[model samples]
Every structure is written in C-alpha cells, then in structure tokens.
Target: MALPEPGADRRTLDADRATAVPTMRSAAPLLKTSTAGALLAIAVMVAATVGAAIWLSIIDQRRQAQEQLTRQAHAAALQIRARLIETEQLLLLEGSGYAASADRFRRDMEELLDANPALLRVELRGRDGQSLVGVDAAAPRPTVAAATRTALSPEAAAAFDSAARMNRLTYSRPYYVTFGATGFDLMELVVPTGAVDGPMIVAVYAPQRILDHFLPSDQ
Candidate 1:
C-alpha cells in the first residue's frame, strides 16, 4: 500500500473531531437534566422527613400537658375532701366553745368564724330557739347572715329537737332564707353542747363560699 499522505491524515483527524464534539454536546445536556431531577427528589424527601418530625413533637407535647392537668385535678380533689373531714371532727369534738360565758362564747365564735371561711353564722340558743351568744359573718354585708335569728324553719326546728333529744350533732334539710337583704340557699348544723336537755350550737353555711374557699384555682 502506498504511504498515507500527511494532508489526508490531517483531514481524517478533523472529521473525527467534528463528530465527537456534537456527541459530547448532546451528552452534556442529558447529564445536566439527570442531575437536576435527582436534586429535586432529594429535596422533597428531606421536607417530608422534617414535617413528620415536627408533627410527632407537637403530639408528644399535647399528651404531656393533658397528663399534668389530670394529676393536678386529682391532687386538688383529695385536699378538699380532707378539709371537709377535719371540719366535721371539729364540730363533733369541740362543744365547750358554746358552753362558756356570753362574752367568751362570742369571742370563741368570732374566732371560729374567722378561721373557717365557709361558715356564714353561728349561734348559741336555748331549746326554744331563743338566741344567746351569736356571731354573724354578715358577709359582703349587703345582707346579714344573722346570729340573732329566733324563728326557725320547720326543718331547722326538727333538727334542733332531735339533737336535743338524741344529745348528738344533727343536720337540717337544705332551705332558702331571706332573713336579711339578700337571700340564701343554705343548710344548718345543730350541735348539742352538753346534756340532752341543755342548750345547743347552731351553724349555717354558704355553699358557694365553701367551693370558692376550698377548690383550687382554674377548677
């Protein structure tokens, strides 16, 4: 074979370069498109993962808050129940407070009223319901929660008579009273002082005051 001419070899090399250039240019666009698609897919996956993590955190926080509220409510309920029991014990055990002299009885009843926010009034009365030593809270003093109340409701009379005969503490049926300026839906406690035929201690409560003084805030 004749030796290849230098000019012909140069022409062949140039043709190969032209074809290769176009092929490389076409491949470049495909490579860039594939890279951009991959990047978009990764971004979507990352966003989904972050969203799931945030939602789970919010749920956990809500659950913890609910549990804390339940515990606080239960603790408050137990405290209120204990206070009620202590008041009943005081009524059953402390009768000398009513049996003292008039001045002493007034002072004692004053102290009792001051200490117990739920008590509206307390009175020392004869079996016939004549008021002796009386202490009235006279609250907000728009109306009087009176200690000098001589007339008794039928329910209060029945309870007083029973306590005098039985020589024990007794409770009256819930009743409404408009003795002073305002009205009250209340209950009475008739506590005997010493013997079956002796004098008695009478007390009345404002139920709303009991809830306000005893229950926890936000309840």
Candidate 2:
C-alpha cells in the first residue's frame, strides 16, 4: 500500500528472476570441467599413438631377426660348397700323384670308397663318357648326350665329359647321380687333374646333407 510503493514489487520480482537465471561468472567451474574433458581425450589419443609406435617397433625387430637368419642360412650353404670343392681338389691331387694307369686309379678309388662310406661316388671319366676308374669297377659306361658332353648341363653324362676338358681345377657346380639313371644337379664337384699336357677328370659325389646339416632349423 502506499500505492504498493510504486514498482517495489516489480524490483523484488526482477531480483528473484536474476537469482533464478545463473550468472556468467558462476559458469567458470563448468568451463574448467569442459577443459579437463578435452585434456582427457587428448591424453587418450597420445596413449594410443604411443601404443601404435611400440607395436610397429616390435614388428621391425622381428623382421630384422628373420632377415639375419636367412643370411646365415645362405652363408652356411656357401661354406659347405667351398669345403666340398676343397675335398674334391685334395682327392684329385692324391689320385694323380699316386695312380699312373686305369688299374692303379681303380684301386685307389676302391680304397677311398671303403675308407669313407660317406663318399657316394668317386670316378674318373674320359671325355667320351667312358669310366676310367670308379667305385663300382665293373659298372659299364653309359653314352652321354652330345649336347651335355660339350656344354654345362644338369645331365650327368654331359657334365662329366665337359668337366674332363677344363684344363684348370674346375668344379662342375653340383649334380646328382642315380643308379642306372641320369644325374640331377645336387652338390657334386668335378675336378680336372693329371699332367698339364692333357687334364684328367675326377668327379666326386657326397650326400647333399652336407649342406643341409649346416642350414638352420628354420631353413
């Protein structure tokens, strides 16, 4: 009354409304919470990135390990090959120094085969594919293909004849020999020995396991 103090109630109503509607100043805590949430999301993203990096690193390490193992296998194969070549050279040197004729050579070959059962085959072949000396002294010489005899081929007959002509110590780059059948490329070495005037052939065969033994288990 007093005429309702002319707008006093209105002022009171306005004050109540102001109290009901939150002020901008009171929202600082909410802003802080929003900022914390954004920071948490960034942390999650960073953690995922780090995890991916770690996973990639482990994969790279495994790849490197596999490559190293492969290199070792190849190196072992090469070493076995070299030792085989050396063995062939030694056998030829010993044979040429002691054996003068086909008979002496045959005897030497038999003794060699007897002493080392691992020696699959040790033979002396003429360029014409004739067996001059061999482990089975009674085995007949088989005809070699003209294509093989003169050139480098996996066919044993031709390779043997081809190896016979090389003047220096030559290795026939590994071949296989089967009974009553042509040989395949394995790990055989053919060495040419004899006087410098006319070289003789010395073909040596051994188990392919010699190389396989050096290979790693994974290989």
Candidate 3:
C-alpha cells in the first residue's frame, strides 16, 4: 500500500520508456522536414544564379554587335573619303590644262560619272557657290527639292549650315529627291573640292539605290 521510492527500478523504467518514445517520434519528423527545406533552398539558389549568368551573357553579346556595326559604318565613310580625295587630285591635274578648252574637263568628269554610276550627280561649285556643271547631264533638276533646297529637314539644314560656315565638307542625311527628268530618290553626298591650301567646296550626290549595298537587310 505504501508508494514505491522514487529511485526504485520499476518506477524509473516506466518513466524512461515514456520519455524515449515521444522524443524519438518528435525528432524523426523534425529531422526529415529540415533536410527537405535545405534541399529546396539549394535548388532555388542554383537556378537563380544560372538565370542571372545567362542574362548577362545576352547583354554582353548585344553590346559587341552594336560596336561592330559602328566600326563598319566608320570604315565605309573612310573608304568613300579616300576615293573623293583621289578624284580631286585628278581634277586639279587636268583643270589648268583644259582651261582653254571645255572638252578636257568634260571628258574627265564624264569618265568619273561613268565609273561610279551609283553617284547621282557631281557638281563643281565655284567659290561663289555656283554649280559649274553637273556630272549627270541627263539627270533633270527636281523642282520639289530644288538645288536651292539644300536641307531636306530642319536638322539636315542646321547641320549643313554649321558645316558651310566652317567651310568644311558637309553631307546630308538620307533623303528622297525626284529627278528633274525622272522621279527617283537620290541620297546625296557633298564634299569640299578645292586646293588643299585654299578654301573650296565640292558637291556629290548618290542615288538611294546605291545604299542597298551599305544597309543591312531587316531580317
């Protein structure tokens, strides 16, 4: 009838068993849940890192492509400039010899126009801004964008004005100009033609059709 002592083997065994069973049961679920959470977190981190890397790579590629395009444009401009310089040299060599005759200058300019038909027209503008003669004699002057209409848009006019004031070679943006004799878009190019030692201006016009060679396909 008296209670067993606290330290008795029978009571101690019962308490130990009760504590162990519940502890084991609770610990099993906690351990499993912790492992599963850790795995999910690792997977998410890996995916985010990979996505960021791919995005950065794409942006870098785009930048490189744009740089390449810029280089190509610069190269094209340089090539055109070199050809113009060569033509100027030829003109100077022949201009004085042909001063007594019109045939010689006409022949030289005609040859240049024939060699580069892509050029819509080439005009030798005197210091007084008078067009001496046009390379394409057949190309009719356009009434819409007449010779007086140097600037197709306001921006183009402003650029031309700046270049003209500086007495430097000036070029206009891509524009459509109806031929005086025919309706066709002419992409214009103007260069300064004169003595390297003195002020001079030369104007050249190229047809828009020629731009097809320089411009890339939309696709």
User: Could you estimate the TM-score for every candidate?
Assistant: 0.61, 0.55, 0.57
* Cα lDDT computed for each candidate against the true fold: 0.75, 0.59, 0.56
For candidate 1, give the lDDT: 0.75
For each of the candidates, give the backbone clash count. 0, 4, 5
Off by over 4 Å in 2: 1-40, 101-119, 132-154, 173-187, 196-211
Instruction: Give the per-residue lDDT of model 2 (tens digit) for 80-183.
Output: 66765666666667646534576766677776555433354556655455555555422233223333334334545445555565555554555544435555
Question: Which residue segments of model 1 deviate by more than 4 Å?
Answer: 1-74, 138-148, 178-182
lDDT rank order:
1, 2, 3
Q: Top TM-score: which candidate number?
A: 1
RMSD of each: 5.4, 7.5, 7.3
Ranking by TM-score: 1, 3, 2
Candidate 3, residues 89-172: lDDT per residue as tens digits?
A: 665554444333456556766677665545545554444444555545344332333354432344445434545466455656
